[model samples]
Target: MPKLMNVRVTTMDAELEFAIQQTTTGKQLFDQVVKTIGLREVWFFGLQYVDSKGDLTWIKLYKKNEPNNCAGQIMQKLFQPNELEIYPTKVMSQDVKKENPLQFKFRAKFYPEDVAEELIQDITLRLFYLQVKNAILSDEIYCPPETSVLLASYAVQARHGDYDKTTHAPGFLSNDRLLPQRVLDQHKMSKDEWESSITTWWNEHKGMPREDAMMEYLKIAQDLEMYGVNYFEIKNKKGTELWLGVDALGVNIYEKDDKLTPKIGFPWSEIRNISFNDKKFIIKPIDKKAPDFVFFAARIKINKRILALCMGNHELYMRRRKPDTIDVQQMKAQAREEKIAKQQQREKLQLEIAARERAERKYQEFEERLKAMTEDLAKREQDLQNAEDKIRALEEQVKLQQQAREELEARQNELQEMMIRLEESKNLEAAERQKLEDEIRAKQEEVKRIQTEIEIKNEHTRRLEMEVEEARQKKEEANRQLLAVSTTPQHHHVEENDHDENDDLPNGDVTKDLEIDSSIVDPVEERRTLAEKNERLQDQLKALKQDLAQSLDETKETAMDKIHRENVRVGRDKYKTLREIRKGNTKRRVDQFENM
Candidate 1:
């Protein structure tokens, strides 16, 4: 076999992922570059070969690296660009070898993301055309005619991309806009000749395929993220351009009711008289009447920045155009509608918060009031229990007094009977009387001393007035004293005069004591006197205890109430801060997020 072209193939540059992910043209070019140079080891931009003419021949550009081992031909040439846009930086090509004479360089920058698909279709179709150009000139038929037809279809597909005006293809695959040169290069024609041929073919097939406009429109909206509240601007109906000031805010136009409208940034009345540079122009709304231009606007306020929008719908709107105030007014109406919607949402949330707050306040009030009331009720029930106990003690005293009175009456009746029996024994009875009289004399003397002691105790009680707590204890002791008096010898002596000690007796005392001989003193009366003395002393002690506890409790409660008032002040301040946070009237949360 004849010596094949000796060369080395290599790809060197940045990673292919980013470049391939960019424009489709870049991806296609990368692939072709890989196959033509790397896979085939055909490192040359164009191949050199001898034709069947028995003479060396030069041919036009070729797209593929077909072998020239048989009686075929080889072409040498690479595609060129008609226009060159200048860029600030230079780009080093990926595939550069020391032996290769061609300089791999680029002086133009492109937004590969925005126009990736268009670039891919353009490069692919042009290469297909170049392939056909080579075949027609050199008479190579290795590939079928249907392949050429398909390439032609691809070029046509590219021309009607992004909402085709002539085709019915759907989905992302059909968004191409170009005419492949392969269809015209079958006869070895240049792109100029190929374009003229396409014009002739388009005249034959202009209205044959109807396009789906709505599908394309929706795809465009989705691509732009209109659902995310993006804003834009464009020109108005008249022709005037504020070229430099337009795209600053980076806003967009919105669609409503089958019409394009600009969102009003704020209420116009607040912003109308203000110039574009004024900081107070925050009240702009969207303009919804199909826009002619989209302007990106910004107004600075209080050392902060805010975004604003203006947009146009028609293609003509991008040209030198004047804005529509009428459309702006329409936008105000639209803004009002949007404002009403937002207000309704806010109002719903506000009402829920208010209701919850009211409920919480009411519950707190109820709980506090309940605590106070329950405490009071417990105290009252205790007092009632004390009263009930006192009433029971009083009833017991009355019952004991009644029994004592009945017993005394029975004793008197028995004495009367016994006296009558004594009278029958006249002389002996006289002796008994004499003995009784002597005993009475001794009791009278004892009574005089006891009375003196009582006077002294009463004088002491008068001087020492009981405190409230002491008084309560004193009252209990007094009740005991009154009980004691019911069983006392002193109570029997005086029926009507109960004194304070004998208060438990019936309104009138019934017990009466007879003058008794010391030799025959009744043990019951002696026991009663001792009990009364003990009760009187106990009453005084109880009164002192009651007064002490009441005074202490009152002082402690006063101190606690003062502390509670101070705590309420702190609670109110904390609650106020929480209220502002919930209402979003403060920027605390925003600041927190910014700091993070």
Candidate 2:
């Protein structure tokens, strides 16, 4: 029975886990990876992992492991504890005349519909950052402009996530923190100064949001050394358009869609003769017995130029090795590999130390956050308590105001009743004055009738007096005659008639005296003056009532204003306390975070 080893494969875009038989070659895993990811152009890439020595070495797909290699052996020998990364050995280069590296062409399934532009930009930025990181690590610094752009790309990546080609890429000219850790260490750069410089540049250029700016950075990253190399389109004898790329290794030819399985490869070590004419690129294999020939028709536009460039690159690749250089070259390569392994081990140990430090810092940050949160909660509770107290105070104030309003209303009612009484009194005074005037007029009429009666009586008395005077004269004459005729019998009769007439006159004088006494009345001017005084009193009462009403309104307004001002002052004081507490707590938390 074959035991299976659990292997985790890392690809350019994803990580895959697989279970393979220990007896199998690395090719088995690679084949599965290619199948799972649907990789079409895959030859230029390989699966690699860091050894226990921390040296990153390729997994040889063509070589078979020893029979003793089991799952444990594979784990101990091939895989790292927690790392798996796939790096490219060669990149497919094609005509990019119409292609822009800043722009990403989307594919199906990788990107979701209605995805945010920010997410796409973030991913794009990450890809560029990875490239920049690779360049930095490889020390591929040459062109100043190119290096600056690559560094800028690295800055954007650190701030954002890796880029996915299936999504739209971001714009570039925006990130401010462009100095990556490697660059900082390499140049002994002051992070603050570098950041300030980038900030100034960003401000001047109207910097983009970090995500959207990735596309612009991607364009710059793409223009790095040896990036976007064009592959020549050639026609084989089978009349198929083959994509050909000449690198330091050799000539590589393949179908445009599938690069993992190349149809023909002319390694520099295996080549015998290579030449190109105006219209063709000709190649002859090293083996004389095989007698196989491979010819490529040049591209239509830059055929001669492309052939020339290929010949030049090939010569450079071939010249490195002399006729008898195999054993010496292998020894040199082994020594370099060992040295790289030691360096990698040291770097790994440093990385572990750094990771531990980071963890401690993160833990401290967590503790600070917890403390801050607790303080915030306590402050909130205090605020709530203060708010409740304020509310209670406000309620008490409102109650007092209500009571005051009720009392004021009662007072207002009393004043209103008093005013009503005054009105009634004024009306009564008016009625009394009218009654007195009517009585005065009646008394005057009675007096006038009495005067008329007196005048009539006087006139009658005058007539009587005149008559008496005539009688007196007659009486004197009559007394003389009577004396002469004393014995006449008519004298007794005359005396009796005079007595009756006098008695009637005395009765009339008595009635006239009674009428005169009844005609006299009290002074009317005194009553009139009393009425004027009552009217004046009524006017004064009305004025008093008006003043009282005005006072009530003013008092109410003053009381309300006082209550409102008190409430505002109390609320302001409480709010100020709350703000101070919050500010203190926030400052403490910020300090803790900074220290962490």
Candidate 3:
């Protein structure tokens, strides 16, 4: 029986354990984690583990040859152990308990080239947010103090809804680690001051959704100098310590002191091959004229990790060049639908919460007033009983009349307010309707214009077609006439010196010959005229065909434009209808409140 190994993979929020064969490849384990998380954009993530050397390494989730055949097989063979297979001997730690399961962290190993455009899935974005937040807090990525404060505010908003004064008092962030220790150490302000600055920014994101807040955080984080770069401490050929960085674009070498800027860069497109043996790594450029990049790591384990990262980054770079697969398309569509649904749900929930809070406040106020009025009435009744009972009755009647007048005035004011709001809503609705109508009319006019133009082009095309056909027929007829003129036999006159031929011919024949000679036309001149006319007809036919083709192309473009406009108009109408429905619901709610 094969041995079953208990492997634990830690994600952003939770740890997942899986029982697999001891010989399970990295690809299988990675796939299991992705399936468990329901992550569609798997390209941006990788499973990270601490090797025996205490260096972080990415698990090779795919075969090297899977990306391309050029250098894949060679690299695959060079990095033995089946691309860092899951083995107890490789990952076991001396101080750790033997009974504990093998641990791995599922993390965002790569970032999108463009966050807003490429990062589509909410789940993917959330994972990135969690990883980036941890990095920022841990000082793994260097963030300026100002930018760190801004990121911390977004983090706070994402974690705890909005910053409430009652809940988030002083020392709220003191216990929680928001910014890096370095950032705090550099600033002279107290912790309270930093919290206040963060709260100021947090207040501005009051109603922002958690996903939006997270997205905003990522957008800012992506701009930092060390955002998505994975840095490895290594030595150059000169024995100088340097940092080798690998990111989505390419590999970069940073100086020993400065991590913000790179000393040299090699884009993935320029790189032809990457191979390493022992602690020696080399990067060959596509341009033979350029020298190869050679660097050395402290341990062979580090070289393996660097190679794995480079391969993965290169594969992703190539993948992005191709079109999206069907699965990707479906995932994008589903993510969009889910995003819209979640937004609607959050809006509805917020609306309900606000309305409930308002009602509760009003009820509390009414109850307090009623309690005070009851106490006053009781005191008055007590005093009246002690004095004149008849006077007490008059006082009660006056109090009742005063209360009625006050209630009437309040009701009138409310009615007036409702009326004003209703009038304003009506005016806004009228303006919106008029605008929509005008837009619809304009669209209709545009459509009609395009249609009219298309019709004109079609008519012109038909006319050109007719002209081309006529010209072709004329050309063919001219060719046939020229052929007939060429084929026609000509009479040959015998010389007068041939006495025998003259004696044999009758005088009538001679007179006939004279008449024939006089009636004969110049065939060469006639043929030349027919040929010229044919050439002219051919030129006209060619011109007509060219005009017809141009008209057809114009007609096609016009039709496409019409279709695009119609789609836009339909989308606008749908949006307007939704807005109207929402307005109607609001009006109904107001009416119900007024009645109550």
Best by lDDT: 3
Off by over 4 Å in 1: 1-340, 366-376, 410-426, 429-596
RMSD (CA, Å), each prediction: 40.0, 48.7, 43.2
Tell me the RMSD of model 2 versus the true structure: 48.7
The estimated TM-scores of all candidates read 0.23, 0.25, 0.55
Give me the displacement of residue 54 in model 2, in angstroms: 8.9
Select the stronger candidate by TM-score from 1 and 3: 3
How many steric clashes between backbone atoms does each model show? 54, 10, 0
lDDT order, best first, reads 3, 2, 1
Q: What is the C-alpha lDDT profile of model 3 across 111-140, one tens digit per residue?
A: 776687678787888899999889888877
1 versus 2: better TM-score goes to = 2
User: For residues 81-190, could you state the per-residue lDDT of candidate 2 as single tens digits?
Assistant: 32444332211111211111111111111111112211222333344345444444443422222145334543544454343333413333233434434334334234
CA displacement after TM-score superposition, residue 270 of candidate 2 (Å):
15
Candidate 2 clash figure, as a count: 10
- Best-first order by TM-score: 3, 2, 1
Best by TM-score: 3
